[model samples]
Target: MTQTPRIDVVGGAYEEWCLRPAWHEVFGSAGRAASAIAAMAGPSKVTLHCYADARTAQVLEARCALEGTRLVAVAVPATCSFRYTHALQRPEVEVPQSTYASVVVRAETVLRFGMLEGDAVVHGKRVVYDPQGRLTPEPFGANGSSADELFIVLNEREALAITGLAEGATALKLAEATRALHKATGVIVKRGPLGALVLDGDDWTEVPAFETETVWKIGSGDVFAAHFALNWAAHGHSATDSAYRASLATAVYCDGRGFPEQSTLDVFPAMPIRASARWMAGRQPRIYLASPIFTLGQLWLVEQVRENLRMFGLEVFSPFHDVGYGSADDVVQLDLEGIHNSDLVYAVADGMDSGTIYEVGYARAQGKPVVVYCENESSEDLKMLEGSSCVLCKDYVSSIYRALWTAMAL
Candidate 1:
C-alpha cells in the first residue's frame, strides 16, 4: 500500500471521517441502504403562490422573482368552513390561512460537500481532502491544494478516537483499532452479520467473522471501512494482515448478535426534536391566545396560561373578549390592534371559531407566530393552524405547558 489510491466519497459528508462506513459496519444491514439527509443543505430558491387573479395576490408576485427553491409561507384554505365551530367564518372570497404551504426542493444536480470529517470510498481509491469552511465543491489535489480536508487522516492518531458520537463504538474500541493498526497497512470493512475484513492495499489479511448468535446487522460496515483505511495506510502492515485486522474489529462490533449494536444505534444520532412552544426561561414570549372571552373553555385555558408561563418565568398577552365584540364598529381595526400589541399570536382555533380565525389572520398579516390550540382531535379547524408557528393542541394539559415553553423561546 504505497501511494493510496484516489477515491471519491459522496452522500452528505456528515459526521467524523464520514464514519458512516464504520457505522454500517457496526450496524450492518440497517445502515447499508438508508441515506442521510440534512436541511442545512438548502434549496437554491423559494417561490410563493397566493391566488387572486394574479394582480392583488401579492404573496405570489412578491416572491416569484426573489425566492426561486425553498418557499416558506402561510397557506389558506380556499374557503373558511364556518360549520367547524360556533360562528366560524371562511369567506369564499377572503384570504384563508390554509392557502399557504412551504415547498423546499434541491436543484436536480446539487451536491453538498461538507467539511470532510473523513474520506469517502466511492470506487476502491483513497481520496484525501483538507477542510475548508466552505460547504460547496472544490478540486481535489495534494495537501496544499485540497481544501482543509475534514476527511479522516488514515495515519493520524485521531482516527480511532473519533468514532461516531451516536454510533455505539466507545473510545476503547476506537483506541484499540488505532493502536493495533498504527503503522499497519490494511482496510477495515464493516460487514453486517458477515463480521469485518482487514484488507492490505487490495488483499484480505483477516476476517473477524461475526458470531452466528444474532440476526441483524448495522454499523458493521463502518468499522470494516475504518479498519481498512487504517490498515491500508499503516506504514508496514502487509495487505494480508490489514484484512485480518479489519475482520477482527468487525467481530467486536458484532458483539455475538451476529448482527451488530443491539440497539439500532447509528453512526449519527437521530435528528433533534423541535419544541412545540417557543418560550424559554430567560426570554419572554409574545403569545396570542386569541379565543372567545365568553367561552368557558377559553376562560379556563387562559388562567392556566399564566400558571404555565410562571413555570418558565415568562410573560404573555392574550386578546380575549377585550376587543368588545358587538361594541366595535370596525372589525379590521380591532384585529390589527391585537397584532400590533404582541410579537407573536397563539390562536385557540378549537371549533374554528370566527373570532379565533380572525385573530389567526391578523397574526399572519403581522408575520407573528399564530400558535393555535385545538381541543377536539378530529376537526377541520386543525387545518387552520398547519405550518404557521401555531401548535394545535390535542390534550389541553400537556399542550398548555408545551405551548408556553415553545412560545417564550420564539
Candidate 2:
C-alpha cells in the first residue's frame, strides 16, 4: 500500500476584515484555508507554517484543531487589513501597516529549509521571488528531492509581482518562468473569478471556475491551493485532475460550506478543462458600463448594450443592471468601485445624466481609458472629454466596438 503523503503548507497568516453594506466579519488565513484542505484530505496530516501575533497564534491553534490539522506557528506581529466591498462592488483594501507578508516569507524559508519536513510542500507567497523576477530557491532551499513534489499556487496579482510580468502577460509565460527559476513540480496560477491555470513542464491547462452566488470569497484561493496540493501531491493525481478537484472544492467553499467530504463528491460537478487563454492576444476585457438607468426603458437599453458587448467576449459591468438603482450613496460607491476594477469605462451620454458624466470624469481622473457614446454629440460637443483623449462614438454598435478596442489598449 502506498503511504499517504504528509503535506506542509507554507504561507502568510493574516487577519482579514471584510465589510459590506449588509455584513462584516473577520477571518483567518493559511490556518483556515489549510484546515479546509486537511479536512478534504481525510486522515492525511497538514502542517501549516505561518506567522502571527500571540493572540492570532492562539486563535489559529484552535482553528487547526477544529479541522484536525497541525500547526507550525511562528509568533510575530499579526498583519491585518480592512477591505470594503459590496456584492457587486470590487473591494477597496486598506493596509494600515503590515510587513506580514514580507516577514512571513522569511519565516517560511526557515520553516521549510531549516525545520519542518514533509513529503510535499506547497508555497503561497509572492515575496519568495526577488526583484529580478526569479524564485530565489537558495534562500528557501528548494532541493530537487525525487520523493517530494513542491507546488506553488499564486493568484494573478501575486504571480505578476513575483515574475515581474505585467497584466495581460501570458499565464504560460509566468508559469514557465517560475518553473524554470524554482524547483517546483508544477505551478498553479489562480485567476480569481475566471478560473485557474495549471502548468507542468511543457503542458498547460485552464480549469474553469465553478460559478456560484458566492457568499464570501475571502479565502477561496487558499482553499484552492490546499485542495490542489492534496490531490496532486498526496493522492498522486495528474496536474489537470488535481486542478479540477481543486475547482470543485473551491465551489463547495464558495457555496458557504466549510469543506468538502469524499461522500458528497457528487454535489460538485467536475469542472471542464480547456486550453489556457493565457497565450491569447486578447482575453475578454472587463468593461465598466457608465450609464443612466433611472427608468425601466433605460435599464432595458443598458441590458441590451451589455448583452451586445458580452457577445463580443467582453465582461460588462452595467451598474444599473448589476446593482439596480439603489440608494444614491450606494450607487455612487458601487459604481466607483466598478470603474476602479474595469480596464476601461464605456459611458452612454445620450442624455448626459449627471451621474454618468461624473463616472466618465472619475475614470479619466484615475487615468483609465474612457469611451463615450452619444446620439448626436460630436467630438466637438464634449470638448472636455475630447481634450482628455476620450474616445467618442456616435452610433451604439460602433461605440461597443470602439469601447472593446479601447479597452484592449488600456
Candidate 3:
C-alpha cells in the first residue's frame, strides 16, 4: 500500500455570522480549509493548526473528528468573530479579540497558508486587523518546514499587502509582483466571481469560474485553496490544472454552502476551460445600475447593489448617485448616455420598475450584457427579459455574482 500524504493547514479559526441570509457557522480560514481537505482527502491525512477559544476549539474538535482529520488547536483567551449584514458587506467584529501563539506543524507534502485577520474599508470607515491576530511572525515556511510544496491563497487585498503593490493592480500584475516575494512555490489569487489567477514560476494562468444557482460567498476562498493544494501538491498535477479544479470546488461550495465530497467531484459536470485574454488585460467592465429609487426600500436595495459592485473594484454609474432626481428629459438622456457608455447593465427588477425595465431593454438593444435581479416579479413580467437573453437571478448574493461574471465575460 502507498503511504498516505499528509497536508497541513495553518490559519485562523473563528465564528462567522450573516444577518441578511441568516447564517451561523464556525471556522475561519483554517477550519474551513481543513474541512474541505478532509472531505476529499480519501486515504490522505489532514491536520489543522490554529488558535481558538474553548468554545471554538470544541466545535472544531468535534468537526475534525467527524471528518476524520486531526486538529491541533491552541487555547486562546477568545476567538475572533465577525457579523455581516449581507454576504458582500464587510463584517463587524462580534467577539472582542484574541492573542494567538505561534503554531509549528510539519507537513509531509502540502502546506496551505491563510490569514488570521485582514483590514477592510467599510462604508468609508477603515477597520484594521487587531494586533493580536498574528499567528506567527511569518507564515511562509514556519508551519510547514518539512513540506516540499507550499501554496499561498489570497484575495486581491491580501496580495496587495504581501507584495506592497498599489491598489487597482491587475490579477496578473499582483501575481507577478508577489512572485518576487517568494512566499510559496505557487501563488493563487482568488478574484471571486471573476475567477482566479495562478502563478507558477514565471508563468501566469487565468482560471475561469464556474456558474452556480446560489452563491454563498463566505469561506469560498478556503475551499479554493484546499482543493488547489490537494490537486497540485498531493496529486502532482500542474498548477493551472489544479487551479481549474479548485475553481470547480469553489463553485460547489458557494452553491451548496458546504464542502463537496470526493464522489461529487468525480462526477461533477464537465466545464469549459479557456483562457480569457480580455480579463488578463485587466479591462474591467463598466456597469450601469438601473433601479427604481423612489421608495426607501428601493433606494436601499440600489445602494447595496452599487456598493457591492464597487467593492469588487468595478466602476458603476448610478443614476440616483450621479444624475440624481431631475426633469424627465434631462434624466432620460443622461441615463441613456450612461447605459451607452457602460459595458453591462445590472437592473433591480423586484417590482418591475418601468424606468429600470426600459434601461434593460435599451442596454440589450445597445449590445450590452444585462443581469437582472428579480425576486418577487412574476415570470410573465420577465418574459421579454428572458427572451432577450438577460441573465435573471432570484437571490441577492447570486445576482451580484452573476452580474460580475457576466460583465467579466464581456
The TM-scores of all predictions, comma-separated, are 0.31, 0.56, 0.82
Clashing pairs in 2: none
- Candidate 1's clash total is 100
In terms of TM-score, which candidate is strongest? 3
- For model 2, residues 24-76, the per-residue Cα lDDT tens digits are 33344456556766676654476777665676677777877776777876565
Query: What C-alpha lDDT do the candidate models reach, one value each?
Result: 0.36, 0.62, 0.74
- The order of the candidates by TM-score, greatest first, is 3, 2, 1
Q: Evaluate model 2: give its TM-score.
A: 0.56
Could you give the C-alpha RMSD of every candidate to the true structure, in order shown?
Answer: 23.8, 13.0, 6.3
Misplaced by over 4 Å in model 2 are 1-3, 21-27, 87-148, 269-410
Candidate 1 structure quality by residue, lDDT tens digits, 16-67: 1122112111111111111110111112321211122222224333432232
lDDT of 2: 0.62
| Predicted candidate 3 versus true structure: per-residue lDDT over 1-410, tens digit per residue | 65446777667788999976788888787788888888887533887777778889889978887888888777777767879887788788755454344565543554434445422111101100111233232434333243344455667777777667777788888776655454446677877655788888778888887777788888787788788777777677888998898889888888888788877777767453332578557676789999999999999988899889987667899999999998998799998999999989999996888889999999999889999988889999999999999999887888987877676666
Q: Number of clashing residue pairs in every model?
A: 100, 0, 0
